[model samples]
Target: MPPVQTVATIRRITPVGAYHHLVLDAPGVTGVRPGHFGALAIGGRDASTLLRRAFSIHRADPGTGTLEFVFAEAGRGTRALAAHRPGDTVDLIAPLGTPFPLPDGPVGAVLVAGGYGSAPMFALAEEILGRGGRVAFVLGAATEDRLFGVERAEALAEHVYVVTDDGSAGRRGRVTDVLPEAVTVTGATEVHSCGPMGMLKAVTEIATAAGAASHTAVEEAMACGIGICMSCVLPVTGPDGVTHFLRSCTSGPVFDGTSVRWDDAGTLPDDLEGAAAMTPKASHR
Candidate 1:
C-alpha cells in the first residue's frame, strides 16, 4: 500500500535508557512492517527545520492504530521532538522503506543489535516465532545504560546474549564477539542485524563465515526520508556485477548483507557505474 501523510497525536513519551520511546496515535498510517520507518516533521510548521527526521518503526499496532518509535536526542531536531507533550500532534509520513524479509519456512534465526537498534527486533522476533521459527538475540552497546531491550529479548527469544564495550553488561565486547556462539547454540541458519555500519559489516562477515544468510538494516543518514533528495545514496553491488549508487531512503534501509559495498561505503569507487560519465573531461592545454 502507498504511504499516507497524516498528523499523529503523541500518546506518550517515556524515557528508555539513553533514548526516548514515543507512542503516537496515527490513524491513517497503516501497513507497517518490521524494519519500516517513518518520517516525522519537527519544530512545528513554521520553524526553520524543514527536513523531517526519520526513525525505524519500533512497533505498530493495527488494531489501536498506534505506532512506536525509539530515538536518541542526538541533535536539535530530536531534542525538540522529545520535548513534545501528550496530545501534541506531529506531521508524519509513515511505513516507508523495505522491511526485513521473513523466511519462507520456519527456521532458526539470530537477531543482532547495537544500542537502541534493538527497537525493531522484538516485533520482528514475534513475527518469526509465530511462524514456528526459533529466535535468539545478541544485543550490545557501549555500556549497560546504552542497551535497549535485554529484558524484553530474554522474555521472547529462546536465547539472549548481552555485550557491552565497557564490561558493564553480559560479555565485555561487541555483539560480534558472542554471535558465533549464539548462532551455534540456536542452530540459526539466518542472521538479521541493525546497528552501526561497522558492526553490520562485521556481523555480515561472521554470518557468511558460519554459512548463514545475513540481512542488514542500515542506519544511513536520510536528509529527506523520501526519494526526492540524493543525499542518502550509497554504493551497492547489483546482480550484474556492477556497482551503482542506490538511495537508502527509497531503495532500501534493509538490504541483503552480501550486496552492500562495505569497503567502498563513503567513497565513490573508481569503477562504479556512471563514474566515468560524472568525471570532468581534462581541460585543453
Candidate 2:
C-alpha cells in the first residue's frame, strides 16, 4: 500500500535510557506490516532540517489507529523528536516498504535482534504465535541499558535469551554465541533477524547452516523513506540470480537473508552495472 501522509498526535513519550518509546494517534494510517517503517517530519515544516527521519514500526494497532516507534536521540532530528510532548502534532508518512512474509504452515521460529533493532520483533513474535507457531527470542546489546523490550520478549516469546557485551545480562557474549543453543533448544525451523548488518549477517549464516530459512530487516541510512533519493540502495540478488542494486525503502527494508550480497552491503560491488560511472574518466589520453 502507498504511504499515508498525515498529521499525527503524540499520545505518549516515555524515556527508555538512551532511547524514547513514542506512541502516535494516526487516524488514517493502517495496514502496517511487521517490518514496515515510518518517515517522521521532525521540527515541523519550518525547521531547518529538511530530511525526515525514518524508523521501523515498533508496533501498530490498526484498531486504535495508533503507531509506536522506538528511537535513540542520535542527532538533531531525533533530539527534536525527543522533545515532543503529549498532544504535540507531527507529520508522518507511514506503513511504508515491504513486510515480513508469514510461513505457510506452523513452524518453530527464532527471532533475533540487536540493540534498538529489537523494535520490530515483538510484533513479529505475536504474529508467529497467532499463526500457531512457537516463537523464541535472542536479544543482544552492548550493555544492559541499551537493550529494549526485554520484559515484553520474556512475556511474549516461548523462551527468551539475552546477551550483553559487558556481561551485564543473560550471557556475556554475542547473540551468535547463544544462537545455536537457542535454535537447538527451541527446535526452530526458521529465523528472523534485525539490527546491525554485522549481526544480521551472522544470524543469516548461522540459520542457513542449521538448515533453517532466514529473513532479516536491514538498518540502512535512508535520506528519503519514499525512495525518491537513491541514498539507501543495497545489493540484492534476484530470482534470476542477477545482482541488482535496490532501494531498501521500497524494494525492501526486509529481505531473505541469502538474497543479499553480505560482503558488499554498504558498498557497490566492482562488477555492478553502473559501478564504473562512480569513477571519473581520465582527463588525459
Alpha-carbon lDDT, every model: 0.93, 0.91
Which pairs of residues clash in candidate 1, taking residues 3 or more apart in a chain or in different chains?
none
Model 1 TM-score on a 0 to 1 scale: 0.98
Best by lDDT: 1
lDDT for each residue of candidate 2 in 1-285, tens digit (9 for 90 to 100): 668999999999999966899999997998887999999998877899889899999999878889999999889989999998999999999989988888766789999999999899999888888888998899999999899999999999768999999999888999999999888987998999999998999999999999998899999999989989999999998888878899999988999999999889888787776778886788996
RMSD of 2: 1.4
- Estimate the TM-score for candidate 2: 0.96
User: Which lDDT value does model 1 have at 270?
Assistant: 88
TM-score of each: 0.98, 0.96
Backbone N/Cα/C clashes per model: 0, 0
Model 2: how far residue 221 lies from native, Å: 0.6
Model 2: lDDT to the true structure: 0.91
